[model samples]
Target: MDIWKLGAIIWLFKSHVEGRAGIGKFLTSFVDNERKPTTVVFHGICWNNSVKLHVMKELSKAGIRSSQSMSKRTSLIDHTVLLLADLNCTGTDELIINASCIAQATQRELHRLPYRWLVLSDAPRSGRSSLWDPFLVDSELVLATVDGAGYTMTEVYKPSPTSPAILTPRGTFQHVLTDTRPHRELFRRRRDLMGVPLTITNTIQESNSSIYHLLQEDSLELEHDLISKNSYTLAKVAFLTLNATPVATFTNSFGYLQNGQWTGVIKELLEYNADIGTNVGMSQSRLKQVMFLDPLDNGRARFIFRQPALSVTANIFSLPFSPDVWIATGLSSFVAGVAYYLSTRLIKTRAEKGTVRDAYLLTMSALSQQGCEVQPRHVSARIVLWVVFTSMMALYAAYGANIVVLLQAPSTSVNSLATLAKSKLALGAADVNYNHFLFRASSDPVRNDIAKRVNSDKGPKAFYGLTEGVEKIRKGLFAFHSVVEPVYRQIDRTFQEKEKCDLMELDYIGYAAFHVPGSKKSPYLELLRVTFKRLREVGIKSAVNFRFEARRPSCKESIAMFSSVGITEMRPVLIFMAYGVALSVAVTAAELLVFHANRYRLRQRRVAVQLGRI
Candidate 1:
């Protein structure tokens, strides 16, 4: 047998023998026998009932004995076991306090003789705040609470109350307070006895008494709303099979499913004004059901919802002029201006001999051969006219062309203002044009279209990218194009680029009285109307501001004039003047060199011819 068991048996024998033998004789017998010290188990008694008698019988059979006696000091038991009885006088809290004191004493004398302590309770209450302290103080002490008769014994121990609580070998303390409230006076006495800070938490019902009505009313209101909103089909079906009563029905019906569906159902019930008791039960059932349900597949759902769409007619209408066209037009104007200025100056200075006309004609022919048309009568006039005409035409053409070019530019081609504002489309990576499109297309019809597109995909699995509306575009993954410019500069730039896109001024149509009015002083509102007027004043003949070909009517008269200049004195005069200027220059250089050579050659030739030295 185990040493402890043997010790217990010896202790039982001694106790029984001592009861029959007197104390002095028992001591003398023990010394004469030279027996080792025996272990004893101690138990607290309450009314010494039949249950206690039965327990005593069981201990006696196990070679363990129990005793209780009033003494000045604590009793000496090699091994002490404290058993508690279910009695009304000594409440659960008081019983726990006394057990705590006994356990503390056992701990102090741990080194003296190996000893074991056991605490057994029948029908012990739970949820007492300080019930866990004794178990926490010692690990070797075994504590148990068993259900006896119609009552359950709930054991609990907490190492620290301020921190997260853990269950000890004993059950939870919170179970203790379910039936009875701890007496405040009893807690005070225990605090005095144990020299520890111990407190009992009052029931939640006792606190918040005044505004409880408001909470109830709110709960009722929420419940109604939830019932109206919840999918009632499932709940109704589940409620039918177990329809013994609403509570029993739901509990029995939903007890087997996964927690998620249960949680959802409980949540729905709560929203519909169900009582707290029902809500709690449903919630617990739902939680259990959820634990059994398959883990959610968020990754797969995201993949399915995030597929990209190809857009067909994005911002084709709002296309800007290409950048290359702007560069070409500007360069051509500058080059033409320089050429006309130099050619006309040369022709004018030599025109006094009437050869100027011929030179002018020749220049016109040369230009005509090169596919350019001359329109003025005089060479200088033609030069000035061509310069002014070309510059003006290039400026206007470039403006219109630039607008088109910007609209068609690679940066703008992937998406346009209307497309960006109207459709769910993404901009290119690192595109600066997105900002311009956003600002300019604010009133475009496409804005509504984009909004609708985004709304359709609204969910956890929605794909958000630049191809979608600019505002709804996702960040980090999606790229957007933006332009940085002074606020005023964007206005000018937009106007310059608008013509190429063939955009017309948008009229500010007043909506019905019920519709909100747009700002009358809006800069965008001004931009549309103001540009129309400006273009008209600048000789652009458009029925509406953006009517194509109206402002670009071919000038037949000018072409005819150029052709006439080629046939008139202009061409012949240009040839003669070229010859005369070449002759004059050649003669001048020849005359100077001939004069020097004549003087030297005449002297040498005369001497040679006369002397016949050769």
Candidate 2:
């Protein structure tokens, strides 16, 4: 039978326990015909909270009740002895049965609630056994008090070959936090301990900003002031020891039923190989895997493309309207010319024989936005001409104003996703981006077309890296799809203001993030939940991001060094200028042809008159 077990014994004293100490130790015994003691102080710590509940159940069945000390003043006076393990112990308790012992917490202060104590037959040194830390008296001290008075220590445990050694439950025992400084307790459980070492994974080592590099310092050292780098970095701080591996990837479909099987970090967690999953995108499908805690960050996948540079020496007047509008105006001028010939040729009009040619020139001049040279003498022709001239005057004035505006402000390269998709430029996306999958699966025809374009042979070749994609975009006639943060960082580090000014990014895809545990049964998952919540309340997480951010791109005008009146910005104006010049040349050619024909007719009439007289 266990030495600490109750045995058939009796307590002679039924009197009240009234003394100087109120709760002292040694020779306090109450026994039955069992193997264990009638009074026992069950050991406890934060990590052992769940196990402690079970021990309480076992104690109750043994016909004994244990003492509980929640706060510092929770009345250990109810029992005869307390297993007081003090974090700041400088006290002593002697084992009267055999040896005198010095407790690590000999000198008690205001209270001994936080202090953890151990009593033994004798103090054991460090090397002989991994179980015992020998600064305290490791005695199997049991107690039974009378009334609200001093209690007695019922049993003492001494180590020997014949006697079984009393053991502290390692699995249930929580670690005593060395730092007693108070905090918001948002990320920490009310009573929980670092029960065991855990395995965790992170992104592969390619950059310093990756989760792997951020958590390196914490993984190497155990006791230091916690400095968080990111959400996952802060999560790592909760564990005193972690076996971190490089396997965390941006997985959105980890636990989802994929082709009748499951994959990703969630699988490793389920199998108990990894304790926590980092930087996993949150989704309803993934929630079925383990569990998702707080988000690491929020971000979007969008298009980043080169912006067209500003133009110079533009035919600013013509830019107010489109090419189609200009074409319609020219066709209207031809119709007006035909109308004048019909309205005047049969009416015996007051105009001269060259009136047909003059009318055509006048119509052309009106459409070109110039003053007409011919004046009409007939009322019907005059009305048609004046109406055309008035409309032309309003158009001319508007074009002049718009030209001034164009000269002051430049145009953009691509204004929207629709423009980018319709453009002949090569489009690409980083092979690792999960949004590509979402885009390809889009129901919208425009988005579907864009996805097909990117995956096509004329688009970006498959599996190109972000750096390569960025290089292609910088060369112009190219666009890339990626998350904003990483691409923003690269541009911040690489591009000048002039180069980055025209670059435009469009937001199209956003995803929710989550941190997952190895299994639903993981005890530490609760600690993670609490810690994650605390981190947010403390303002460690902001709307933009959780950590370091890059400066946005900016620039002054005339930074391109050399540019021109680019066709992209001055298309309408240039087309109008060309149309006006062509019309003027044609009008001049018509006048010369008419003048020569009129001279030939007069010469022929004179020769006929001379022949008749002979």
Candidate 3:
């Protein structure tokens, strides 16, 4: 009878060992097949070595790597960690104490929370225990615990950024000792918040320079800048798709990193005070602090200015006709000049005594439509003169017509960043938060030089107010670095239709658009991504973008609207006139010198002759 009892006890112990092993097997399968983590970290007290070792051994068997160190901090955003805790290690009846110990051990190492958790204990699952209270609000986690002969799992997630972690049962893994079926549905679709409340923050300074302002609940808009407006609207659409309530908060700035810390919207996200950030421009530095979703605006920040005058861009005298046409004109003039010279020599007329130089001068006078004292009376010479006159008259008429058109046409030379940097146009940027920072931070040589020029000219006040910048752009020769939509709106209101015809832009900040940002390892990130993708796929996003951002206003007025020519437009002509005057002065000086020399020589000759006669 004693042998029979001993055998029954051994059988019971074997069943318990198999049950524990089966739990380890299931966890190994989940980690290896489902999560497929590159590196898995294990955190457990010394007393929980058996449970951790069993799982680690199984993971190793499945060709997975595991780490035992818990002191080093790792980004939970990219890496997955599995934590196991023995709830009975402390000999405490209270579950909160055990949970607190687990939270404290990991809270320092993991800035956020672990990817998965397993709690082992002989105690029954209780309703009064606050096991998940120590973690950050809405941690979006999956945890499992021993439930009788089987195991039960629950997920902790937030419906919104401000909401507390909601614990929901994810069903149980029964028949652990014999079950071979894979259940991939446990963690899938867990991101669907099922109508939770989230908080989204934006930079809505109370000052007049704010990117956006509150018009109503969940309604934000910008008067001049539409980038923030469009993003805000898209974020709202995402929240609706998730059936989550969005709470809006406003701050003074988008956020700036100062003294190794962040300020404004970025600070709120880092501290987990907000779920998502609106109108956040993506940058390498910002990416380290938070995760950004799909780009809301792909529009680049650029230097917008009027196209410069053609004369300012190129020599107006040479631009009216092509090189070939100019060559033909020169050849024709030479032939006419030479013919007139030969005609005078072959058929000498009493009225016309044309030397080589005189014939060339006469040809130029005909081209210029000027009168000459000498006339060739011979019929052949006269016929040659008429042909030259008629051809030059037609060429001069075409040249004049082209010059008039070119005077009004815009210059296309300053269309790219390299050209813009080399151009004489004065550079400035809108006084928004990111311009100065991005400009100075750029590594490109051209951008660096542009930033330097702006700072050298304007110093600390290098940036201009939107209206002030737009006003300078309208005044001409000023390239204001700003997003297009806001500048377009300002241009639409103040600039004339004729002025719009010359409006041009050069790419400065090359971002496709500003993106909506969320906290690092945000649970709503995927939902935000899918929501945006859906909006784009269905063309809703395009509609919202079109409504807020303004395109370049069309040129309604005739481009030939007459205005008095400024020095900038007539620069080539002025330069030509200055050269002509300088040459004329030089020739007059040479002639005077020659006249003085001739007078001196003649006087000496006269003196010699008088002396000889005496």
Candidate 4:
């Protein structure tokens, strides 16, 4: 006896020992009930399914038509007796629910209560399965008002609440949507593979990847959008059952970091330990190690680095021009000043002959927007002044417009893998092998550099998972290399509308697929291949990918705030200004010291000559 069943049996029989609802009372309530139901339905806890089915058979004396299949019993229902067997609930209760029929079946009244009128659960109410298993379509059950200890739940069911499921739940609910004309319990028929189970390895217990659809939250099971879940569901509908085991490594194409006997998920498949591996990333390299089914979802190997920190350099003035442009501007102005001085031929009469002070003032005043104290009398000098003045006016207008834009909506620097690599920010991969994996596959030097740049923490402490790597990414200056779906989950949660721009991604290096370990010789490999093509074509796998993709688009949220620009946003500009002012003050002080020192030295030399003459 498995411990879970033993424990469940102890609790189920507890009511009998306590003189609560016994087998006799349980029998009395079922056969001669007020609402005599012809058909009963059993589902939810499957471990108890075999024993529960036997009990139902004896109660009805082989006369009552019963089924665990929702599709099979749909036609047989009317003033329906819905025996919600293995319903993990506290005690028992008589309940009423309105089931709206499809465009075909009219409205039906469904009533539910245990035959025993007691606690038949494997565990207490706190430990019951959160949501009912199997698809409950177009059916809204309000079990708020019920009698005694029984199942009561307001179930608006579809595995995960898709966007449309929120408003309307109208859809064909059955194990097999296609296959037979007016599909019978034909989906129930399974092929005999000598009772072979699809022995599978997955992190269904811990990972909330949504790929496995194993998330439990707010009493909702399989909460997140999942591709793996759809694949699993389709396989079951195709008469393929999976017996799963939990594992850490989904697959190990790159084994540079991972080691030991318990290696890759592929190892299990290769060893014939697991017939199938769910959530396996498909790669040509991995394909060599073990075979894969048709691709379920091909996730690219991309890097999700921390959004680059906001820039702090404030060179708004210089940004509009390159160094070459500035040099040309200064040279042009100096040449015009020289031309004005020489063209006037004023050096012979000018007191400040050596300085060309008048010519300098002429151009400087025009640039500064102040009228010159002295204007050139020569026609050629006036022409030069006019030309220089006009050019300065045009430049001033252009500079002003650009500077205003800089102060308003600042443009972000380009983000890329090469840029991240050049930066002080180091890289970390969720899986250590991924770095080595990419480098070998990519011959491009830039990609090689990008792959090698993965920060191994200078030791063996490479991030073994995405969650740990993401925490470092959040802190800043860390690029995490992983796939889209997991990274998108973090991006959706951690980033704000404004910070979406901060989220960065690169193209996938390679596509990964769900695989079962085998060569072309394996019979099961072909079975999975056909299923994959059919599932993907019908959009079962694609829908999950599309939903997640729609949820996370390229950042549209404004990084620029709605309010006026704050000092933080202008951090770079302010820092630049402060440096410029300090440099200007220092230069001015140095020039003043040199001028005064030269004058003092000249006076001392003249005094010495006078003393010598005296």
Give one clash count per candidate, in the order shown.
60, 39, 5, 13
Candidates sorted by TM-score, best first: 3, 4, 2, 1
- Count: clashes, candidate 2: 39
| lDDT of candidate 1 over 1-614, digit per residue (tens) | 69999999989866644432222222122222223343333333344344445444544554544454312234454333333322333564455445434445443233121233334444443444454444432223334344431222232333323332233332222223122324312111111112222111111211133123222323222111121111121122222222211221121111223443332233333233221111112124344322111111000000001012111222322233456855765575455555554655555544333234443444444433333343445566566655555555555554556444333322322233343443334323212211222223225465434333333335322223323322322221122321111111222233332222211111111111111011221111122223223434554323221211112122233221211112222344466679989999998999999998999999998998989966
lDDT tens digits by residue: candidate 4, 1-614:
69999999988766544322222234334334323654555433243444554555555563555555445334344435444433333222222122223224322222111111112333323212333222222232222112234222222222122212222211211211111223222111212233344444433322445432422211123222233443344444333421212222233332222453435455565566554555555556566666666644344456766455343323465776778978888898899888888877754545334247788878788776789667665566778888998998998888778766655443344266556556666666765444444544357766666655554324453444656776776665666776556666766676665655566666536444444344322234444555556667787766654543324436575554543556655666688789989999999999999999999999999999999999
RMSD in angstroms between candidate 2 and the native structure over all alpha carbons:
15.7
- Can you list the residue pairs that collide in candidate 3? 160-197, 297-513, 298-512, 298-513, 299-512
> What overall lDDT goes with each candidate model?
0.32, 0.49, 0.69, 0.48
Who wins the TM-score comparison?
3
Between 1 and 4, whose lDDT is larger?
Answer: 4
Q: Which stretches of candidate 3 lie over 4 Å from their true place?
A: 1-13, 23-114, 117-128, 134-197, 206-221, 224-233, 297-300, 324-328, 346-353, 369-371, 417-422, 428-465, 521-523, 558-562
Tell me, by lDDT, which candidate is best.
3
Better of 3 and 4 by lDDT: 3
Candidate 2: 10-residue stretch with minimal lDDT? 169-178
TM-score of each: 0.20, 0.49, 0.78, 0.50
lDDT tens digits, residue span 1-614, model 2: 65334332212121111221112222121222223333345333232344345545555655655554422232343223335331111232222212222232232211122222333222322223322222121123322222223221222222322323333211111111122224423122122232344455443323334444454533321111112134345555544322222223332233434586656556766666665765556566667767666664454457887753334323445567899978877787788888876666657844534366877888878877777656766777778888888878887787777765565453474677676677666777777535444456467776777777776646554445767777776766677886555676667666665566567776544353334444553434545565556656776555324344333566564443433445665666567779979998998999889988998988999999999999
